[model samples]
Target: MPESFPAQTSAEAAAEPTVLARIEGVVGRLTLNRPRAINALDLQMTGLLDDALDAWEHDDAVQVVVLDGAGERGLCAGGDVRSLYDRIVAGHPDETAVFFRAEYALNARLAEYPKPIVALADGITMGGGIGLASHAAIRVVTERSKLAMPETRIGFTPDVGGTWLLAHAPGHLGEYLGVTGTTMDAADAVFCGFADHLVPSDRLDALRAALAAGGDPEATVRGFAQAPGASTVEAARAWVDETFSADTLAEVEERLRAHTDPAASRALQTMGQLAPTGMAVTFEAVRRARALPDLRAALAQEYGLVMWFGRTQPDLVEGIRAQLVDKDRDPHWSPASLDDVDPATITGAFSDEPAVPLWD
Candidate 1:
């Protein structure tokens, strides 16, 4: 956990509502309340958020929805992969499947929300955090913001419409970011279309006050928004494009190995540390997502991919155990290298399955 956020016992955290919703005049304020856990989304939080959104969507009294996190550390870190690992280990895959189903539905709903949604994406936001905030109408980030979709590090590809969002980012930046699990700052986020307005961290309270007082979200955000400094990703666009535009993961690795740029070398090092199978899957998924029509299509495909990985790959559990449980950085991925991953296995992972449907 980050030091900036308050800590809580698991029992205490579980007792509290994962999501807190209050009506402040016409603005509906929804806060992810588990600061101790970095407000990580669990199955229960997914349901609570979805239900709140559903009710607020039809309520005439609600003019806008402001989504934020409770702690100073930032918004959500991601989903509760620890719980997912436990359930899978106990031979209860259905539980994890249900979580993904509800979470994806929430993502889709936010993407199509009728009213404006102002997401205060402060601090560390990654994986499922991106799902929640990136889809919002008005994504507000601060200087403290650190955003990413780092599922590849945990033996999973980015889920919750990440493929759609990343695929549409400038150049092949999505490929580089997704595979490498690189974190980007507020400036990089705004440049890549992940965030809209960049507000200073200290001014967030005032911004929230304005929203609670029935101020227009856009105007208020604009009032507080400032330049996001320099965007490192923008500056490295040519390098990112050239290095990540290869036809396959192997080719991408070769290019990175040959490239003289220190950033490319660092990315290659990061990729080397991640689960090889996960990287291969992410590469193919992003490529496929680039050609997909919309969020729904990308999500549908991602649903199948996750289900397959959960059922067939040991890397998911090993990765989670290494990073979260054992605290050992070394994850013994089953297919330890990209060359060891079978193309047929990759094809099978993406194949259609009886996944919990995203939509009725």
Candidate 2:
């Protein structure tokens, strides 16, 4: 039997559900159905996922869970940043708090879920998408996967437990990816601990069938997942660890410019295009998260930083406008260069607690 809960908030009565949850054999399947937005997680979608998880957790009949996206482009593009930007520009920035709090809470729930959740980290999984997939018990990546925590590009630091994961990545890759917003391929994802297995995109259907047919999730995955080739991240580890380990962003640039590797050159150019405040804050956030006790602590710290960005920083709104809303590729970042960002702003964002609670 199949169960589908169509979203009721839609003006059209016949609109398809943005989230589809059903049972096949002993497996519970959840799909993010908003292909048009590349399955971006909105408030409604988050709530629906939470509800489905609540039901599945207690259902003895449902033994395994599979989460995938509806579209070919990816599992999820990330959170609905444009919607948040719209609310901010409307003079009601506080309204965005509900979405962030709910989303973060949902992420925590996923991290601790009782059942084995097989998350298909295929295609463009970034920002909020990584939160959903990477925390799962069984994370699968494919050759088509393009994974990143690309918040800095839009003048935002990573959230949704992003810092916690970034902090825990191998060597100095966390710091490298955190500031530059670099995308990782399957091998890189596996090497960096973002994914557990690499399964070819063509074999995904067989993989899903094996899961639904009710075998051990791990064993079934082992049968289908092939070993990925050498990670470029691994190849560049000497320069990555050495350059990014510098105490200051200035030194990071100095080291990067000195390296002859084309990877180093590309990274420097990408960093130049990012918002300075975002780079400064994200660099600190990744380092701070590494020192924190756990994911919950990192999430709390990230929540405070997000509130700071929403309420006080001009770069967040400006960056979103240029990148998402206006389609203009240029964002005149506040303090425009890494050298101009105030050190106090970075410290204060991590220190101050938000008025809204993530949990009651």
For every candidate, C-alpha RMSD to the true structure in Å: 2.2, 4.1
Please give, for residues 21-118, the per-residue lDDT of candidate 2 as tens digits: 99988889999987767788889889999999999999999999999998788898888888778888888777888999998988888889999999
Residue-pair clash count for candidate 2: 0
Error at 198, model 1, angstroms: 0.3
Per-residue error for 52 in candidate 1, Å, reads 1.9
Give the range of the ten consecutive residues with the poorest summed lDDT in model 1: 1-10
Cα deviation in Å at residue 305, candidate 1? Answer: 0.7
lDDT values for all models: 0.87, 0.87
For candidate 2, the 10 contiguous residues with the lowest summed lDDT are: 1-10
Model 1, span 149-168: residue lDDT tens: 88888888899888888898
Give the Å error, residue 106, model 2. Answer: 1.1
Q: What is candidate 2's CA lDDT for residue 308?
A: 84
